[model samples]
Target: MHSVVIIGAGGVGSVVAHKCCQLPELFDDIVLASRTESKCKRIAEQLDKPVRTAQVDADSASQLVSLLQREQPELVINAALPYHDLNIMDACLKAGVHYLDTANYEPRETACFEYHWQWDYHQRFVDAGLTALLGSGFDPGATNVFTAYIAKHYFDEIQQLDIIDVNGGNHGYPFATNFNPEINIREVSAKCRHWENGEFVTTPPLSMRAHYTCPEDVGTYPIYRMYHEELESLSKHFPSLQRAQFWMSFSDAYLQHLEVLSNVGMTGIEPIDYQGQSIVPIQFLAQLLPDPAALGPHTQGKTCIGCLVRGVKDGKKRLIHIYNICDHQACFREVQSQAISYATGVPAMIGAKLVLEGQWRQPGVWNVEQHDPDPFMADMNRYGLPWKVTELDPEFQLDTEEHQATNAVH
Candidate 1:
């Protein structure tokens, strides 16, 4: 029986545990761990099946290694903070266990997120004969697979790509983040970047915007262009593309709150002296916000995330948009979580299953798209998060005059 240990007991972790437990034939034994044992215990209690729970500091490689050694899990699904990605990877290497994570690593001191730090471990993981799968969450995860699926079946050579993520869900909270507030704020406030003309062009944060109408009545939303970690790997892996960009939908209320927070220095990551102690403003702000896990019951609506690719197929120009729509309420009914966590957690489980099942197992670090998209796409439909693909008009365009004007500057 193969054993798997899941780190982090937050929203995504809870869903990962629930989904893995449902597939006892694959998971065999399930262990859920986090910084707080109580959180893990609470989630385990909600599950119909039993799951072992533990508390370990993900920041400390020694602590994680100790737990992994004791648990003896064949795989470690890291649903923890992005800041602890490398530490958990180190522990996985030491324990000789396969590793999978939902997000790429981001340093705590800086909001910057890139694959360089983790990719540097390619040789080490390969030498250890362990597989490290990165960015198994929704956008980076499913979107990556979506792109690859299109490239394999639809496009002869994908030239332009646009990844659009829209969360039509409403948690009813005035200013709470769907995930970790610190991570959410930092990502949104960072400068936007997009690939163009063989180089990455930077723009002011959320400076570029466009209106997109989602298929299947998911509603239209204003999406702001932003830099996502998957673009780094996708562009590098598939060099045929001329441009790639990521856009996310955000409400005016959320933007207004973020602006106020940024203007007042509440979203700063750097430490500031406060009452004879150093404290990061964003960290403090995170504590004051409602936990993302608690918002599941209140959140309603759906999230649509997909990839829009344009290229040539059989010597003819083609455009395709492939996406998945997840309902927050439906997810809560099954896993007691909202769509944000559901979207991310489902893919994390699928990635780990692929690794353990030997379908995606390889002795090196890899992103989701690096593997065959056939099985993963099949599993997504068999599991939750079913997707659809549609051919777009050849002249379909997402780039607006504003985006063009901004791109012209560089």
Candidate 2:
């Protein structure tokens, strides 16, 4: 039996608590904590088993260390914002606890997403005999595992990688983000970058677009190339790759709204004087947006996320697509949350479970793909997010005319 502390009582945090409680034997004691104690208590009320609830600002390492000292949990699952990742990791080290999170750290002042900050702590975690798993969420989490699984089973050498994320779900709101509005907007509005021959090529945000026809008739949508943190780790971990990129589907309405917001300076992260009080425009806008947790009941449709890999196997070039399709209503029925939160939260629980089971526990800061993907892939099928792997024709190509034209070889 293991005791665990879960921070951030938001949508993903709530699902993590519920999933952890499902296996009482493994997680005997669970404590859900966040800045808003009431949110934690509310989520606790819905669980089949009672979990301890507390309030602590995750930004304060001392407060977290004190809480961990009192609770003495073996692991801390951080479902909080990306900005608080370092503080929570520091607290875990001080409290002598293993750490896991669904996202990498991003400083509050910048929208840049990279794993260098967390990766720098590899020696610290190793010296302390503690484990810190970063990017345990869907794209960075499951998708990373999917790539590793494919490489282990199907590829002799991976030559190209494309991670496509599509959320066909609708929340019935004209303008609302599925997760934290601030994070979502920042990620979408940032400059685009993709790994190329021994370097990264930078482009304007949403400048490179490709039409992706999802399997199972999930609808064809325009996927815009963007720089995601996983691309950095994946390229470094798997050096065979000559090119790598990440793409996400976006609706016209959403893009239009984002453009208007950007034009009006509503999405700016820099603080400006407002009535003698310095305020970040994006933070203020986040306050006015609908809470993502409250959108579950009103959300419908599905999300398809996967990795498409082109590699060589047995001296023959091959392509494989491995993905999972999640329904919002089905997830809500099980966890009272949409598939977005469910997809991320389920993996968070699985990562913690692996650490507790000693399967993935090791003394170092690591990404999900750094471990064996077989166990994680098996758990995904056993859990809610069932995935499928399909081999594509060798002649199949993902590059669109626009993509080819924009990225023309000189």
Candidate 3:
């Protein structure tokens, strides 16, 4: 029987545990761990199936190595902070276990996030005979898979790729993040970029916007183009992509509040002297905001995330939009988490399962799309994240006829 250990007991972590429990045969042994033992214990208490809980600071590789040594899990799912990704990867390498995580790593001191830090470990993991799957969560995870799916089945050569992520969920709060407030705010505050003509063009945060009508009656949302980490990896992996961009929805109210906060320097990541002690403003703001996990009961609406591709199939121009819509209430009913966590957690569980089952096992650092998308796509349908693919007519504004025709020539 293969054992699995999940790090972090936050909203996403809780959903990962719940989803793992639903398939007890796949995950014979499960352990939930984080810096706070009580949080893991609290989540484990809600599960009907027994799961062990542990306390380990993800910031310390030694601590994680010690815990992994004792638990002897075959795989480790890291739902913890992005800053701790390297530490956990190190521990996994030391313990000879496969590693998977939802997001790319960013330095704790900087607001920047990228795949370089983790990708640098490719040779190390390859030599150690361990597989490290990066960005297995929804956007970087499923969105990546969606692109590969289209390229394999529909597109002959993808010319333009756009990843639209719209979270229409409302937590009934004036201004609160759907995930970790610190990470959410930092990501929004950074400079956005998109690849075009083999070069990156930069834009101010939330500067470019487009209106998108989501499928499944999810309604219209204003999505802003941003430089998500997936774009970085996808652009490298999919060379046919001439222009690649990522868009996310944000309410006017949310943007207005963010502007005011930035004006007052509340969004600053640098430390400031407060009461004779150094403290980061963003960290202070996080402490003041409501926890994302607590918003599960109050949040309502759906999240629609997918990939829009303009390419060629069978020597003809083709445009396909593949996406999944997840309801916050449905996720809360099933796992006591909002759709954001559900969307990310479900894929994390699926990726860990893929590793444990030997379906995607290999000794190298990789991304989800690097492996076969067939099993992962099937798992999405069997799990909570059902997807849909639709052929677009010429009227689709996501791409131009010239771009489509160019890929058709490939």
Candidate 1 lDDT, 316-386, residue by residue in tens: 99999999999999999999999999999999999999999899999999999999999999999988989
Alpha carbon deviation, residue 227, candidate 3 (Å):
1.1
CA lDDT for candidate 3: 0.89
Candidate 2 versus the native: TM-score? 0.97
RMSD of each: 2.6, 2.9, 5.2
Cα lDDT tens digits for candidate 3, 1-410: 67899999999999999999999988989999999999999999988699999999998878999999999998999999999999999999999889999999999888789999898999999999998989999988999999988888887799899999999898999999999999998887787889998988986766677888998889998787767999999899998889999988888888878877887888888899989999998899999999998999999989999988998777887889999998899999999999999999999999988988889888889999888898999999999899999988735884211111101000
Error of 1 at 226 (Å): 0.6
| Model 1 spans > 4 angstroms off | 399-410
TM-score of 1: 0.97
The deviation in Å at residue 58 for candidate 2 is: 1.0
Tell me the TM-score of each prediction against the true structure: 0.97, 0.97, 0.96
User: Of 1 and 3, which scores higher on TM-score?
Assistant: 1
Instruction: Report the Cα lDDT for residue 200, model 3.
Output: 82
Order of models, best lDDT first: 2, 1, 3
How does residue 236 of candidate 3 score in lDDT?
91
Instruction: Judge candidate 1 against the unseen true structure and give its global Cα lDDT, from 0 to 1.
Output: 0.91
lDDT of 2 at 134: 91
lDDT of 2 by residue, 13-93 (tens): 999998999999999999999999999999999999989999999888789999999999999999999999999999988
